[model samples]
Target: MTWINDIKHTLNKKCAGLAACALVLALAGAPVLAPAQALADVRKADVVYGQAVDARGLSVAQCPSIDAEYAFVMDKDGTVYFERNATSPTQIASITKIMTAVVALDAVASGAATLDSTVTVSAAAAAVGESSADLQEGDTMPLEVALKALLVPSGNDAAVAIAETIGGSEDAFVAAMNAKAAELGCIDTVFENPHGLDDGEFAGDQHSCAADVAKMAQYAMKNDTFRAIVGGGDTAIVVNRADGTKPTIELESTDELMDYYSNAIGIKTGFTALAGPSFAGAANNGDKELYAVVIHSTSEAQRFEDARELFDWVYEHELDYRLANSAQTATMTVNGARTEVPVAAEVPHTEWIDKTVKATLADPEASVRIFDLNGNVSQSLEFDEVTGDVKAGDKVGTVTFKQRNATIATVDLVACEDVAAPDLLEGIGIWWDRLFRGLSGQPQVASAVTLNETPLVVDKTAVAA
Candidate 1:
């Protein structure tokens, strides 16, 4: 009886293995019978499956009561993960400081100004708003310190002061802000005032699209100085006094999301009767990070809630859209010789395919195209002889992935060499060809060539005899 029970258990195990193998073969579009037969002796096993969800299926219901006019959620790469009316222009409230901070930081980075340089507060900046940094007109402080006060405290006074220092006056600063926005590719944005306080006319108030704000944020975060300033909850600065009394001023961040969301990074928030509540929040969850813009919410809390929801959706679904079975290569010409360049992805290569369906590579080499950040064709090399060496991170070629004629994605190709040069003869031949090519009718050929035979040399004595 015991032997019979053992035989039954072994048969159950065999059956389970067969079922799992069958499922894998079906998903892979492989020969199903082979896997089924291989696993036929197995029985019980645990298996997991992934289901495909369409955009609409993943989208959350709109929040009507929040009174939001526009909202957007973007991945770290500036891809719009989700959005609603994100392109429409709307009053952005204090989020205008994001632009202000970016422009000011740009000035410092370009050597037009320095963060430690002092700017005397003007009577105008001192009186700009009720929430002043208490900066007296005659008082001065380092630009870096003032920026922290402006951003962290959301001080209207500090905004005007920084604007005056950078733009010569608040009005001039507003013009500069608008110009900088255009430079930063914020096409739908316009800034009439340095601070986001509502102007009587909608035109007077600072206005921007959610998408534009997200772009600006992405650019600003690239600046190490700006990133540091924005990521902090508060900063302490020394204020210069006329009476020989030094005072320390503490600036607190207005963004409540930083305090609540563990992964939340530094961004900006704004509010006004006309603009309502607006917030730009950035958060990083392990490998994936996202930015959320909530514009014109009924209340501050509601905007924060909306931003959180957007981040949650991003973290949950980011892996679903990644590239699968991706590969990269770099090609470069050395000394007029072409060589295969090796390349690597900045991030790990990964993809999540639907378990119900199988994906296959259509072509090995023609599937991708590569380009530089400026959209220039990547450098590629061809040679007649052996391929030369290439170093990692060296620009070699580009890969562009396409379905039919439409492009799906682009990646960079880099050299795998630590250091390399072209073959000696190839290098000399390249120079020699270039020197004579201008005089000859033959068009220039950029590809490298390998020589199979040495050129003949005449002997002077033999020629004379």
Candidate 2:
């Protein structure tokens, strides 16, 4: 198909002028349109709404003109707000460093490294790529400084240096990054380098989908150190060299959004000859944030434009398509006994359900056996049949929602009871005279029995049948 046709198919738009311009650029191998200019056009397009499209359904018309590849926009809650071919893996360019940053910060949080800890540069790290922090062999800097350079300048050298500092080598660090991606349920992502420089031979295996990148971005934003580094606009550091001379380097952010969008937070951008321009960016509109990923754009400018279009689209429409509150009520069965556990949230809770679901009862059946905190199944409890009054937070029962029969969502069966526990001893005592009069063989007097210096008096008599 012609490039124009591809653009038309990808964006589902019949913009003759824009399509012709994109087609000419693609065929001539020219740079894609600038993001700032494209976004100006998009603002006009938004006012000329074609129709009320279903937000749940995918639409190519909403996507901007770029090199056709995977793209997606996700909300803070992990719900996909917009997507097109988001599952397909593609050359992600430097966006891979988003994962690198997340893994580095995680290692630091785990005490594997510290922000203030200094790391010596090695020859291998210095040799990674053109986008470098200009480190010489044996040059040293703190982890926090390196991260600012790596993210802000898109420094491949800084990525390699940090990897080696934390994992002993870039190879070991890539392994840790991949392992962490897997742990976070990024199923379609893989990494061969800490810096995300494309390796031609392993192109197929060394890529991530747009959705996977969004997930990684989400994970990184949760770290205080990672957030601080990415959120900064620029950083200045003294670059120490092996020859005993130091040069100060001013690293500026590659994320243009930091300059243009008032609420823009920090993220990463990537580009290569083969991969084109790919970007993963996030912005906060109040407590709610949105992440946008665009892969394989025709030019660097186009990538940013596509990302901005996505951000603007989400900002305008996300609340309209916000997921409604969903709930699942389940019953627990053990030792042939059953109890109901209701699961709910005060607000609509939405999450990407990728892993196995699990549930545990706050109170398991007395007859049911489970392990203690130490992992030994030493205690057994019979299921207490739920009865009487219950309150909101009261533990009526415990339930775990499972995927592949493994627990994921847990909720307590709360008592609806709003009152205090009933007193059984305060009401009345039983009569002993009625208990003795019914005897057939002998008549015994009712008496209070006491011992150990306590007094007891009663009428005593013996009778034979």
TM-scores vs. true structure, each candidate: 0.58, 0.57
lDDT of 1 by residue, 66-147 (tens): 2356777666776565556777898887788888888788889889899887877888888776444567777788888888
> On residues 69-88, what C-alpha lDDT tens digit does candidate 2 reach at each position?
66777777775655656767
lDDT of 1: 0.60
lDDT of 1 at 295: 84
Which parts of model 2 are misplaced by more than 4 Å? Answer: 1-68, 200-204, 318-465
Candidate 1 at 149: error in angstroms?
Answer: 0.7
For model 1 the local lDDT of residue 362 reads 20
lDDT of each: 0.60, 0.60
**Model 2 TM-score on a 0 to 1 scale:** 0.57
